[model samples]
Target: MDISQESGLVWTEVDLSGVFDLDVDESLELESVGDGRVLAVSASPDVVNNVLVTDNGVDWAALPIPNGFSPWSVDITGERWLILGRDPTKEAPGTQILFSDDRGSNWTELAVELGPFDGTAWIGNAIVAGRLIVAAVQSDTWQPQLDEALDDDMAYEPSEKHVHLFLSDGGPAELVAEFQGWYTGGHGASDGFHLIISGPAAEDYLLHSPDGRQWSSTIVDVHVTDSARNELWTADPTDGRFKLERFEGVFGSDQVLTLPDGIGWMPDLAVGPAGVAAVGGPASPNDELGGDFTLPDISIEKNGYELRYNQPEGGITLWDLNEDSAVYVFDAETLQSEGEFQGVSEVEDASGSNVVFHDPETGAELVAFSGEELAAAVTEEVSAAYSEYDPDEFIIGWSTDGTDWEWQTPQEAFGLPESTPDDNSFTQVQVAVGHDFVIAMVQTYEFLGSDFGEDAPIGVGDSQSDSTSAYLTTTTSPSPPRWFVARVE
Candidate 1:
């Protein structure tokens, strides 16, 4: 795979093109268990699915599902792999949380249930803080499928009254703090300390734990970051602008850095270590494969870090959150100078040092300016090239904050093309940035070359047809879909 770099960040790709013999058709998540060992979960509904483990993307092995429960998500706590899923019961509502120590070869299931979990149910989002492994059981209002007819007075409002928290030690699950309201956010032990959970309410509780056994309660709501203990985002009621006030938690001491504001804080504004951010917000927004962001009248701070608009001036104000700070404008004018610059498409607030942006025309770019002495950037050729329905060929881009996008080269430079020919056609895929890696998941619909020679072809002979030709065609039988994972270093 091609490797790209600027400052402390390095963009690399791992080839998972045809790694799995099965067409991955479910939700996929990747967890790094240190020592370069990576665990991948193909969170499928059918119990016949296999659990995959890999040391490097080059080689992979399969582990049995152990039970009939369908996995919802996976998390890594210390040396254990926690796999959370649901039981077959739809009426009573059940949850299954499993712990894997031997790279998922074997599993120990937790017998704990929050009892009559109604409405929407999700489990197994675990974070390890000290001896405590807190898993969030979040439920949202049940809105039946739009295609499914509903009663006239059917409620679309979420019935989520509380977020159930649990503590486990690779054994029986114990119920912990069930915070008020649904759990809107959970940071998986950011900093290996402080498992931050939000969404209880506004004066809502910010349930945090430094040590698993003993916990402290606090009431400041911002984005969850492992880089910093806690960050405070405040805005003037009269003006929409906001500034970040960060402090070392426990002591309740913080530094108030007055910032020029234009962007409002999305309830989930998080800052990492080396807190320099574009700070304003991103100009473009995208979610899921067929997903579009809903809130416009709502605010950015309400939805976390996604920026909604860029100034007509073609740039947004910026700041560096490091010790020796210098500020610069997050410029997209040069990129806009390339074309219409159809807004910033995909954004990665990678690590905490640099932000990456991707536009179909602008490609991928990385920009980081800690000080004039420490400014770096890398951009790809700006062309509205392959608008073809391709997800694998996505451009890797960057930004200091999340706003202005700068294009960088692509994953092909690092040997990550799907096949030899070209990457297009397959569409369902999504990628997000993590502490030191890029996690991408692709949902497979049509079967790969997995079940070869399975289809029976029908040849139709046109009797009265002219002296001309016949056509031979092939078809892909839809199989139970699963998903696969790739971690870009």
Candidate 2:
């Protein structure tokens, strides 16, 4: 929840109970909001039959059925939905667009050509302006890979691919215009709204569309052999290594966010209020090995931060919030493989915030993704762990690293404290880590029970008296002897 940033220190705290339901996914699918709250759309091809949303981070609501495929893209205007789809297993004719007026609670189908040709692949939003919705969709015809598919030449059926820009009427999902190769991945907010596509047998290209209809495409001149591509993504341009070029008049185009070599892999794109945040996977040997198990890097945008998660073949998921010092690296085998990350909490009291990421150097603006931060202490370590919560008593705790954790309360460190005879209760708890400090903030309540009697009651309506209080506690994570960071002074 706490990530360090530039300017020495920058903090953005969000209350995440307002827009989410407990059945959401562990990962976030980013959505940008122009006239309303940002949404994080979640769809699990393995579990849930429906898609849901976490608005800004708090409220959780199910998206109305868009009946196209397992994976889909969402674009919201005020309360309208622009949903897209393409099924990997089914023929392309099944890919259709759906719309909704009442959030995702209900929906209406839009006319889209579902084809017998297996062409449509990745779809991206290029621009949203003045009631015009511009997007890029890729199409390729590949014959099904047989069970004996092994050799590189035998693995794929070589076919021509085309990337097209589709224009819509900005009402219910309707296609108004189309531009065919500029194979754009998820578009970035650089320059205006720049839609980037990895070119065939040449350098990747960036297509700029302001009104979401007319666009100018430019080849980036970064070349790669036609056979080298296992996947393509839009990376965080500031990292400096990935050849993400700068194009004028595109979103974030005024400034460049570079991708350092050996740092990022397949960049999953996310956009919120901040700007375009592309999170990439780790640069690993397995990534270069060219297999079906290649774990792609994941990135999402939100206000003030570009969040990324890396999933390697045999590792945990690691999240690095750009310029934010807290890099949460977790056991991916547990979080993702074991399906822990897929199990979103059912706690309804969570909230979300709209994140606006600004290019620190150029001050260029872009939106990031929305997320939910629950009131539970989410701990991650290199071992097996468990957490317990008492809804009736409003208490919670967890453990991972060891038996004697300095992170819990006496009630938590041990079990629940012995109930006081006078009836004392604790409530409103919070924990935080500061310079050499672990702080616990809380409030208390005390009540005096009335005298019990079968026939000697002074009055028919006897009650207990009540009092309230508040306080804080500080401790060490590994107990006092273990200093997290020793000071030289």
Candidate 3:
């Protein structure tokens, strides 16, 4: 697969297949810490998880996971690593937060007081804003109901939900704001100066904080996704169509782009020095097979059932799937269409102002990490930092206008790998971009088809379900999925 057509950069596949003796169905998560360091977390059953750190793309070292703490997510800033997880050893373990100042060498648990809740408390999102760490916490309480009318069958229903915003400056986290409803949705974003936590309650509400301590609430009609510099990117569906908008302040926003017809809502958005890219895909319900939908040089069967096709358009072909998705790129400043590509499942910004797009159509899987001019722009900004300012001190740098800052690009995009992977499927791809390298985690199931027979189990020890038995009985290999990592310099 071509890494970049413009830059002629090719992906150098990294052989991390033997890094951990994990089952094919185990979950792996990656995050790009600044200074060319990438963290990989292998989450297994019963908290037998592994935290691996890589300073370079080729070499990896294992980091200790705090005792009894099953990490749900990890966030890094400078040399500090914050892990949000649950410690089953706690008497009333709900959600626990651990802090490491020396790159996971040691850890200290941050005392978090989530008020009081009968159910579980979860850290929805946590981000490092300058020296202060901000987190959105959500608690849900469920009440058990025993219905005598139905033979006393017990059922649990959500009885209460609460959201809280917490702030900490390398010490115990302090609750700054709390709400009755799940307004924040445990979602938060920061662009150095402005921090926003927004979610759908009775109506959409956004909680904005400038210093992570003082916050103001505003009702928004759009769902804010990512923030960069002083602007916020949101998926605006107010006009009954998928629209991408850039918000300058609380209420001021400019519509960036409206997705094309037949395309569902924009599933992903990535902002980098090069520009902004939005992924729109998987044909809308209105464009199903029965409709009079037409494409150039393509024939459609007018059957009620769903139809999937690949059509070449604008220098790329739609991915061969029941539904098709495309990537729309726009100039960061002009907000004009840069271009669009087909078969791209997700888009992400690497640490050095680089943007990476993953196309999993070709059996080998294609990744495009482009934008050299933007990388230079980021280097210039970081070069202007104070002489004493340590690059390992924080992920974000301070500046006069807040625009002169750096960000540790999000480690992983939520709801990614749009396609589910089965025993014979190989369509899962995850990419993480660092300052010096771009790592792609490609999951392939070709090995599984041969390793396990029709009756043999695959994921045996997993407590989630009897996936092994289910896979052996129900799954058929169209083409077994393959797994590998591609490191691009």
Question: Best-fitting candidate, measured by TM-score?
Answer: 3
TM-score of each: 0.44, 0.38, 0.50
Q: Would you list the C-alpha lDDT of every candidate in the order shown?
A: 0.39, 0.37, 0.44
lDDT of 2 at 244: 36
| Tens-digit per-residue lDDT, 1-489, candidate 1 | 121332222434445555544443333444433323344555455625445655544456665666556665554434566666666655754666677777567877766665567765567366554334676777565556555546675445455555677777656667766655645344434333343445535553455555444456566555332112123422221122221211221111112222212122111111222222211221122221113322121112111122222322435433233422323334545534664333333333543342333333546432322222112211111112212323222333333333333333223322333553432223223333333343334332333353324342211111111110011112233233233223332
Top model by lDDT, which number? 3
Best first by lDDT, ranked: 3, 1, 2
The per-prediction tally of clashing pairs is: 44, 77, 9
List the candidate 3 regions with Cα displacement exceeding 4 Å: 1-9, 34-36, 45-49, 88-93, 115-121, 141-144, 147-160, 183-202, 223-281, 285-426, 445-489
lDDT, residue 19, model 1: 54
Candidate 3 C-alpha error for residue 70, in Å: 2.6
Q: Over the stretch 94-132, how does candidate 3's per-residue lDDT look in tens digits?
A: 666777878777888777675565687767667655466
Instruction: In angstroms, give how far residue 64 of model 3 lies from its true place.
Output: 4.1
Model 2, range 205-229, lDDT digits (tens) per residue? 7667665656676766442222123
